[model samples]
Target: MSLAAETREAVRARPFLRDALRAGLVNHSAAATWLAERAGLDGDSDAIAAALRRFREDLPAYETDPRAASVTMRSGVGVVDDASDGDGNRAGESLLLRVGDAAVVDGGDRTAILATGDVDVAALANALGRLAAADVDIAAAGVAGDALVCVVSRRDGANAVRVVEAALDAVPVDEN
Candidate 1:
């Protein structure tokens, strides 16, 4: 394809680049040079810069939509391999989730932050990003239907809950 097409594809493949372009926060010439090396685009730097300029015009402005969700924290959660001596099948302390061989069971060393109500993958993604920025290490995380859950160390539970709530309040959405 043309250099313009290639540049567009490269930017779309990198969300940060796309966001920068949409916000008009990047220098076209510098971005072109970076893209040439990063995306292996073979073209004159000036031409690639021109392409980036054009591509930026085509992308929609960046925006965020608040997700209506309630966040809650639950302690004593842990992840285990469901196949381990059938311990994951224990009664009373119910299982939060089981994926493949791994299962998040109740009553463990970790804490779980659960967000329900109009929550989806995007909300979860935003929450995860905020959690990472806050230096909270996630043990297990998932979003299905209206439920979004993140398992983290017990010490980080309170901070993770706040980050998740804030992230859900302004989940990013890029319109095309």
Candidate 2:
């Protein structure tokens, strides 16, 4: 049987594997390692790679951002339709606040710090104020780093962006 057919069978047998793949927990090497460990079979790396290739080809592709630093804003309302990206594609909309230690993997060790969160404007403003009080510099804003992401649920979707923008704008920008 073909590798794609085999992978489909495997996924059908183990549905969790699909979630693992979506969550980025299992790639080609990882799957091989897992199978080798579980079945006590000496699976070659080449076989694992081929299986992964087949799996990818057989599955429906989902849109994802490759850049690690992207910020996404999503609404809480379940019924709100996603905005069109102008290319007949509906963008994946999710509100996420993320903070991470930014470091270049290929280059020498240089790093910057980042903090993010998806929350109500009042709460976000309060948090920002505290950070400002502690002397953290306000960096970028507006769909980028340090930018305020506003997501409106289907119920409150009409003024989501405006509300978020206003709250973010109220914060003092450091000109230094």
Candidate 3:
């Protein structure tokens, strides 16, 4: 494969690098050197940097779109394993989410943060990132239709709500 192809593949393998390049936040020279060593690209740094610049030119500029949604926090949620028959069906316990054998059921020590309306996977992704940065542990998270649900400990409910709200306020959108 050509050096340009290898360089592009290297950048693609690391999502943050691509994002940084799109936002014009990457130092091309430094990135090229790092990619050469880490990605095993047998090429000159100058050539790799030039390839990166070309790749950047083709990438859409990074942008975010604020979502319109109502955020609500519901306490007393819990996760139960073996709550499903592995057929994507819940065991009828007021389930908020069910995947394989685990389910987020009502009435537990956890809290569920629900965002409905104008919400999608992207909104959920943003919320999850903020939640992680805030040192909040997530039990389960999912998005269906216009609704997004994130489960966390009861103690982190209030802070999770704020973090989720801020995250949804400016969700990163794909311009591709």
Candidate 4:
């Protein structure tokens, strides 16, 4: 089977894998390592690389400003066509907040950072503040395993890395 076909088959067999890959939260190397570990098979770096490349290329095009903040779902009262609930509450149903679908977001010229170590929230907040201070807009951020994955504007990727490194350095190391 072709690499693309194999990738699609693998993901189709495991929906969670597709969700994870589509989320764009995990790095290709990390995903490959995980797949190898999960399948109890030897790591095939070449196959992993091709699979990831094909998956990315298959994603839909969604052009957006790298500096623009990602879309966030806001919860509010939404009208329901059917009154499933006997009470009038059905007409005023509460909506749940959800994160934007990463597949619909532009990945071009975006930098993905996967930092593994002590992921201190305070340090992360500080790093975010520093980015804000520098006007480096954060597109998306999520915690994947021991690493914090963040997507930011490519133009500010280098600066973001430097700022995060400095922030991490400034954090006090606990002597345990």
Instruction: Give the higher-TM-score candidate: 2 or 4.
Output: 4
Estimated TM-score for each candidate: 0.89, 0.28, 0.90, 0.37
Cα lDDT over the full model 3: 0.91
Tell me the tens digit of each residue's lDDT in model 3 across 1-176: 99999999999999889989999999999999999999999999999999999999999999999999999999998999878656655545687887767788887999999999999888998899889999999999999988899999999999999999999989987887
Output the worst ten-in-a-row residue range by lDDT, candidate 1: 82-91
Q: CA lDDT of 174 in candidate 4?
A: 22
Q: How many angstroms is residue 164 displaced in model 3 relative to the true structure, after the best TM-score fit?
A: 1.0
Q: Which candidate, 3 or 4, has the higher TM-score?
A: 3
Model 4 regions lying over 4 Å from their true place: 1-107, 172-176
lDDT of model 4, residue 72: 21
Q: By TM-score, who's the top model here?
A: 3
Name every residue pair that clashes in candidate 2: 74-94, 74-95, 77-153, 97-117, 141-147, 142-147
Ranking by TM-score: 3, 1, 4, 2
Span of 10 residues, lowest total lDDT, candidate 2: 103-112
Cα lDDT, model 4, residue 131: 69
lDDT of 4 by residue, 21-112 (tens): 55565477776666656644343856765676678667543221112112222211222234344443333433221133222122145665
Location of the lowest summed lDDT over 10 successive residues in candidate 4: 63-72
> Residue by residue across 1-176, what tens digits does model 2's lDDT show?
65445555565466457545534456777776665565443447567557765675555433222221222334232222333356533345422322232211211121112224433334355334443554444331223444343222233333333343333434322121
The TM-score of candidate 2 is 0.28
TM-score of 3: 0.90
Q: Which candidate comes out best when scored by lDDT?
A: 3
Report every candidate's CA lDDT.
0.87, 0.40, 0.91, 0.51
